[model samples]
Target: MKHLTETEIADWVTGLHTPAILRHVEDCPECRERARTLASALQLFRESAREWADNRTPPVRMIPARRPKPWAVRWAVPAVALALLVSVPVYDSYRRDRQARAETALAARQAAEEAEDAALLSQVDTGVSRAVPAPLEPLVSLVSWNSGSWNASAGQ
Candidate 1:
């Protein structure tokens, strides 16, 4: 008798074979053992598939939430405002002190210049008040001679 092919055995194991191949498998011990092994492996695979499908869970995705600012950052605006409010008057006072010093320096320089001018004018007045001696008076007159005095001196 011809033995059953592996395809016939597989088909018989899955209940897809004709009655003739099934009869051959029933009579053939070797083919019966192969069919029995294939059936048992297929049953095991179906049980594993059912367990996996029933117990599987879908993946979860997490989204991040927005957090509030820290305490220091929240108070930074008021701190800066307080600093500006405290600094404005101090800066104004510093500017006014600087301007006063400059004006005092300028007034002192003007007073010194006026004192020097007054001293020079006093020296000029003293020089103009002093007179030459009598012997030098004739020499002074000759130096002041005009054209008439020049002609008279030429005749002499």
Candidate 2:
């Protein structure tokens, strides 16, 4: 087969040719090398084009035209108002419940402290009503007094 022309080679590189071009490149070393060079040049051109496009800044900025607002935007305010109406009462009830629990705990603690204080005062009264301390009560039974004098033996 005759060697492929530059256009034929280009078309083949771009996937535009038939099986004959593939056979020629396979059979002829010179045409095969030419096709490979063209393919490499095309790949370089594509990379440079991408890089140039990325580096280029747009000269004129176009503002996108806005479409009509959706139905949700119209009800946005009512939705927020409903959320607040639902949340405010729930928050208030939560705060009131916490306050009631704290008050109950405080009352119970005060009652316990008062009971402890009352028990302590009753112990003090028992200690003060004793004529003699309990440790010396046995000595009292061995001694007696009569006729304004000390007596060692009274019933013996």
Q: Give the Cα error of residue 87 in candidate 2, in Å.
A: 1.1
Worst 10 residues of 2 by lDDT: 59-68
Flag clash pairs in model 1.
none
* Candidate number with greatest lDDT: 2
Per-candidate TM equals 0.40, 0.47
Tens-digit per-residue lDDT, 72-129, candidate 1? 7679899999999999999999999999999999999999999999999998887676
User: Which segments of model 1 are wrong by more than 4 Å?
Assistant: 1-69, 133-156
lDDT for position 25 in model 2: 82
Candidate 1 — worst ten consecutive residues by lDDT sum? 59-68
